[model samples]
Target: MPQRKIAIIGAGPGGLAAAMMLSAKGFQVQIFEKQDYVGGRTSSFTKQGYTFDLGPTFFSMPFILEEIFESSNRRLEDYVTLKKLDPMYTLSFDDLTIKASSDPEKMRQNIEKHFPGYGKNYDRFMNDTRKKMNALLPVLQNKHASLFDYLRLRSLKAIPQLEIGKSLHDVLSKYFDDERLKLSFTFQSKYLGMSPWDCPGAFSILSFMEHEYGVFHPAGGLNQLAKAMAEVVREHGGEIHTGTGVKKFILNGTRDISGLELDNGETIDVDDVVMNADFAQGMSQLVDDEKRRKYKNIKLQKKKYSCSTFMIYAGVNKPVDLDHHTILFSEDYKRNVEEITKSKIMSDDPSVYVQNASITDPSLAPEGKSSLYILAPVPNNFSGIDWHKEKTDFRDLVLDQVEKRAGLTDIRKNMEVEEILTPYEWEFDKHVYKGATFNLAHNLGQMMYFRPHNKLREMNRLWLVGGGTHPGSGLPTIFESAKITADLIARTYGVKEEKA
Candidate 1:
């Protein structure tokens, strides 16, 4: 039999996952990335004695990846180092300072301590959410099988009972009535660039994975996972060409894609193509005018895109008492979201997320020092805020907010070096689509099957993957999106799914 020839564009988690899986199944897979290295949104860089994940701070559903390697007769632990986060996160509001834990009992205890009578309610909510996750994760991790197919399975008893109708905001409200607890539980929606009020309740399964399955950080940094994934792609016989951005597809009037067109005007042939990019960019640019028009004319929310952070990766000379993840919010929570979504810029107060990796991963910095990535969400590029002036202003504003929030009066002086990432930087590189970081806001109409299909509507030999697809955003979800797209391709190409 002739070898299957396929091409995967965008070497992020999604693209790499698809390539590796198909290659293992005797497919000739080639991966093309625009940058000098793989790991699109998840890529990182080291500058001035500090390293940053560049994007995606938290890790969950790593088991989804473990299965990926297992199918290829490899072990994830042998290939990469992963550590469970203790006290998963530290979130600070004006009046509340919460230490979120991975242990369910410990979490219940903390809730009880912080909000009286929340323990039992939280326990029940967690139990139910875990059930939902049990049903959902497997579906996302392996493939995009028919929804009707899952309906026949017995374990998915939670399928119809999972309340897909209500928004996550309303679902949580029904269980825990406390304002702060509700705020904390639903904040995960932000990971999808969606507001809880409108994002589907099904996304709350993230609660089960992050809180129950737990969050992880690879040994060197989050980007270490990307490095390992690249290794897996190579080991499985996939070729990755970075700095070779795909400009478009070379399609024949037969309405079949022959291959891809490079930005430099070269064309590479392939039997099949998978795109792990901004779905719109792939359709509008890669596909010709005919097929691109078939995509659901999805409109982005006019509501301002999420704030693009002004990140300064700092190596502080002093060991600041920061956790692996520290989220310090501005005075008012509602105002913080409002300023970004409604007002569309840095408000009088802006929330901050600061990561001091050296606290746990000391290798990130020298002895007696800390390496920090400070992120302050500003308006995305489309918000009409000028970056030329606000860049310095926001950087200083971040330092001031940290000093006030942590009571570290001279935090800036302790900095050994700094590398900043402004919104413009994100737009220039990640195609983060106006710096929305999480891609095409996971709003109500753009979620689940409602999301852009893993298989393009009009194209026969083409498919889609990455943050913009069904499961939507976050590193793990992107990986799952790739797996679903691959499975769909396999089935369409006559590869029968393994039966139990």
Candidate 2:
């Protein structure tokens, strides 16, 4: 029989991960990325001699990444050097600042230092949530193609611990009385681009994983993770075609995806096609509405989406005193969150996240200088705010907050160069649907079996992988989505895993 030719759309982390798995299994794999770069949002760029990660500054759960590399019979250390961040990040509230670390004793001390007598609360949270994490971890690792698949024994056993009807805020409130401490745990919901009050309780594990297992960073930048995966794909005989934009999928008789047509006017035939682009964006652009039963544009519009981000990359001529990561909460954080997620309006007092990587790794900036990555959450395109007009004002607001709250009071004056990316650019330039940078919201209705199945139900020989699909967003889960799809395809084709 001829080798199964698999065509993957986009060279994002998901696509690169899938490519590694398939090529290692002896299937012919070809990945088409619209940009000349390999990592999509996870890629990096350099300006004025300072480097910046396009998206995803830090990673949680190194084991998932390790498993992917192991699946290809390779070691992760060979590709990228990993470092565990000890004071993972600093959280700044109005009255106090707390440094979060994975060391239990240190974390307890920090909690007590800030919230006084809250050490017991941290202990209780860890003891209870660790069980939930173990229960849900295996479930996320598997494929949920149909309702029946999700009803299996493992999932059935884990159901109650899923925390069906509670919000993350509600869950954390059960332990901590102080609002700031509660906010410290709940703020991780932003990884899903969600407000804690709205993000599902099951997702509370997001913060637990960070405090328990720890967070990681690659030596050069987080984008190196993607670059390393791309390298593995090539080592295993896969081909990645960058600067290739897919126009649409070629279907036969309305059900089977035969191949893809590139925008450059080229057509390639293949046995299978995997979508690694944004779920809503890819479906609307590649598959015609007549063929889509579940995710037509109108229905997609109705589905809740994660909020977008307004990013600023600043290269400074002077060194700044800051941690590897810092989060400055807005004065009225809840209101700010509501404004972004519910009211669908820009917040004048937006929460800001700053990454001062130069202090940790000198390679990102020139000697005696530093770089800052500033991100402020904002409404996705659904807000209808004209970013083109608000861009300048928004940048000024973010910088002012950074200077005021982040302790970089003189940050603006030392700026040697800067770049800004608004939600509009995410939609128009990056082809993200609605500029929802984090993809679909993880609401109960849009999760698990209800989320887009790894195997596209409406069409054969087409699969989906990435933040837009099941197990729902974040780098670890995104990697799991790739593993799930790769496993499904491998089983279907009777392909055996190669021994290391």
Candidate 3:
């Protein structure tokens, strides 16, 4: 039998997942990535012998990644070395520090120390969310092609656990009396780029997943996941063309996409095309404006989006005593979140997440040197913040906050190399829409069947994957999106395995 050809746009985790799956199913898979390297936002770069992950420092939900590799007859352990973090992360509030642990008993003890008499509430939270996650995780693995599809058996069963009409902050408030304690769980909403007050109650499972399954760190970096998937694709006879980008999709007639025209002006035919690029960015440039009704450029511009980030990757001359991961909350965290989400302005006090991977893995830096990957949540490109001018000042602000809050006293003077990625760069250079790194917001209006379909609604033979699609963002959901799409494509083509 002849192999069917699939062309995937972007070599991010979503694209790489689909490539490996389809290739394993005996299809001719080819992935085109704009960047010189694979992994899109998940890729990494080195400076002064120090390596840094471009995005996504936290590696949670290891089972999702494991499932993908297992389905392709590959073992994840063979490709990437994952070390489970015991005190998964440290959350620093203005008045207290929380040593977040995956072990429930340890976490309960920590809760007792910080918020006395609150350990029982932590137990209650775990019990409640475990049930919700059990019902929700499987439903997320399927594609919601239509309203009817969303009402399927699995989703129907999950409806009761959905915790609709409440925000994450609202849900956590029921358990914790202290606002800072609530912030510990609610700050996870930032992972989706949504304000905790705006992020849905159902997403409280994000914090549960971390405390339940534990967070992980790859030996090199989180970016290693992409390289590992790319390796699997090649092993399965799939081709990955990095440093190559698709200029546009060629239409057969009106709604049928036949092939892709490369940026280099080379045209290639495909049986199907999977888009892993940012939905708004890809749709605006790749599809004709006239044909796009739901995700038209004007409409997309108006949609609620996740806040962008200001990133600083610095290789310090000396090592610092810090946890593997640390989140330093602003003095006025709620106001800071509001500044990013509602005000759409840079904040005077920004909540920052810093990863000292060198402390966890010795390979990321040279002897006695460490690399610091710092991310500060900021307004998306819609804010008109003039990052070109503000980049230096923002960097200084981030450094000041780090030194004051995180106790990294000498971060400023010891920089061997420094790289900054602002929202402007994310949009203009990285092909992200509005420079919203977390993609579209996870509001009720933009979720489930309302979100961009796994199967392109207007165009046949075209599919969508990644954070922008159904099930929503984060590494696990993005992987689930690819699985859902791969399953749909396989079913559509009536592809079947031969019985032994």
Better of 2 and 3 by lDDT: 2
lDDT of 2 by residue, 1-500 (tens): 22999999999999999999889999899999999999989999999789999889989898998999999989999989888998999999888899999999999999988778989989999999999998888889998877797678889977887799999999999999888999989999999999999999998899999998998879899999999999999998899999999999999888898888998999999999999999999999998998899888899899999999999999999887999999999999999999999999989999999999988888999999998899999999999999999999999999999988977888888999899999999999998999999999998898888899899887888899999887888899999999999999999998877758
List, residue by residue over 117-206, the lDDT tens digit for candidate 1: 878887888888877776765555543324564554642654664576787878889778866777778767767765566667877777
Candidate 3: residue 169 lDDT (0-100): 95
| Candidates 1 and 3 compared by TM-score, better number | 3
- Point to the candidate with the largest TM-score: 2
Backbone clashes for every candidate come to 1, 0, 0
Best by lDDT: 2
Model 3 CA deviation exceeding 4 Å by range:
497-500
Query: How far does residue 25 in candidate 2 sit from its true spot (Å)?
Result: 0.2
Off by over 4 Å in 1: 138-165, 288-291, 296-307, 496-500
- lDDT per residue (tens digit) for residues 270-322 in model 3: 88999999999999989889977677888988888999999999899898788
Error of 2 at 455 (Å): 0.4
Residue 88's lDDT within candidate 3 is: 93
